[model samples]
Target: AGSSGSRGPSPLTIGMADTIPLAVAFHEIIHSYFRGTEESKCQVKMSGDMMLSFPTGIVGVLANNPNPAKLCFRLKNIHRLDNVLPNKQLISINTMMSTRDTTVVDFNMPALTALLRRQSEKNPTAQYFNVDILKYQIRPKAGAASCPFQLVAYWKCEQDHTDLKVDYKYNLHAMSPPSPLLNVSVCVPMNGEVKNVIAMPKNIWNGENEQALWRFTELSQHSDDRGVGSLRARFELDKGPSSKGTISAQFNCEGATLSGIEFELVGSGYRLSLVKRRFVSGKYICDSEVH
Candidate 1:
């Protein structure tokens, strides 16, 4: 699809025109897996990340175009990029940030023309493109965000009967779109082990001799069914009320960052495919001492 004008190379030119020699060679880059029968769409991977405490934390997003990418490309700028073409050249990376939609970064870097020619001539296949959009700090005392997540638990023990209940919720306000949490898990460290225990939702169970666990495929206000989630368990202890130990939990959520952001590129002649975004944490806890 060569046309009048500068005859410059551009992202919109990568695999966009069947008539172009380079575009015709890598026509398969846009496989069915990327998008059904329809090709010519830019495929990008997107995800969000949040690392912090109630007092302060960092949130960011990662976008990547996988390997087998010499023919493929990504956007440039902001985050660390590798194995991909420069934004104005052969590769492109989509950046993600955790600020509100109001304070997003601008993606207007000039010299974006004539990149495809060099990328195609030198390397036919290489690493994909990925960009980290925007990342910033959030101070609750400054009125940026309140509590990000919350957990409540109660444990009681009698001679032959022991009862435990836990309730959990995440502050939707912290997330712009209030995305749901993924791989959610709740655990309570206990003293003794017990079989034939009773779990309210049936998904909750006893683990080892010192812990009980409850897992959810996805946790959110809408997915909670009741607007909130509550898990309970009843079991008998071999020894009397020894100790309830400590309770710990962890989870990950993809989609939007704490800032609640969105992005777009204009006049690039490139069509950004569907974005894969997410937010995750290794270990997290909510208590009076920690927010």
Candidate 2:
């Protein structure tokens, strides 16, 4: 056995499955142990050897906003294999939007691969292997309003000469419980300056680069204790009418995956260990209409 050189708490432990001891052992060791002469001995050895040791788990979150419809997906590999890399691994993503209207626009896998390649190239001692998988993207003709859980924005502006009063209304609805933190960023036009901002249920607000950032924590399915979880924000702009600026948002919810991805072990002879993956939304944006 080799040390994985991991620093934190060990995620692996020994337990009993039925009457058998579920212990971690290398593939070669299991194969050698099962090599026997008698039929009964071979059967016993094979049964014991069937237990494979591998680490598998994933944690992720997905976020979206509806000003300039966009999506950002991020994932992490939580498997705890010390020195061994799987022979084959594949990650597949499927969007739940209506196949007729929505399409994937940008996927970051190519950029990620290029980054990894650059790092490996810079460090000659570092070994790298590309996973075999097909990446995809889609474009929605009507934006992300059709998503199961989405944020929709509408703007109203009244202009009196050079002065303007703008009211922003935002609605966030979810069919299922999503991540607890909802991040909203609204871009302010160059000709306009934000005068005041207010949100129901009280949230944190920060301004940078002519954009306002609103953060809502501990969000539930309803906005209040008595109603379904939703959010609304109104912003007042001065100097000019509100322009249709980009609105982007992000959040992480458990038990929901944007891309229905699955993992399987290939050329490993058997299901030697567990392999898990998770997908979450990152920086999802949608277009808004200002009237």
The C-alpha RMSD of each candidate to the native structure, in angstroms, is 15.6, 21.2
What is the RMSD of candidate 1? 15.6
Per-model C-alpha lDDT, please? 0.40, 0.31
Question: Which candidate number would show the highest lDDT if scored against the true structure?
Answer: 1
* lDDT, residue 190, candidate 1: 60
Model 2 CA lDDT for position 54: 18
For candidate 1, write residues 1-291 as lDDT tens digits. Answer: 111132222223233222211111000000001122122321222222211110000000001222211222222221321122223332233345322222222332221112322333354442222232323333221221233345555667776657877665566775545667767777766665554478887645545555667777877777755337677888776765645545566666555554333333333323333334445543444222111
How many pairs of residues collide in model 2? Answer: 31
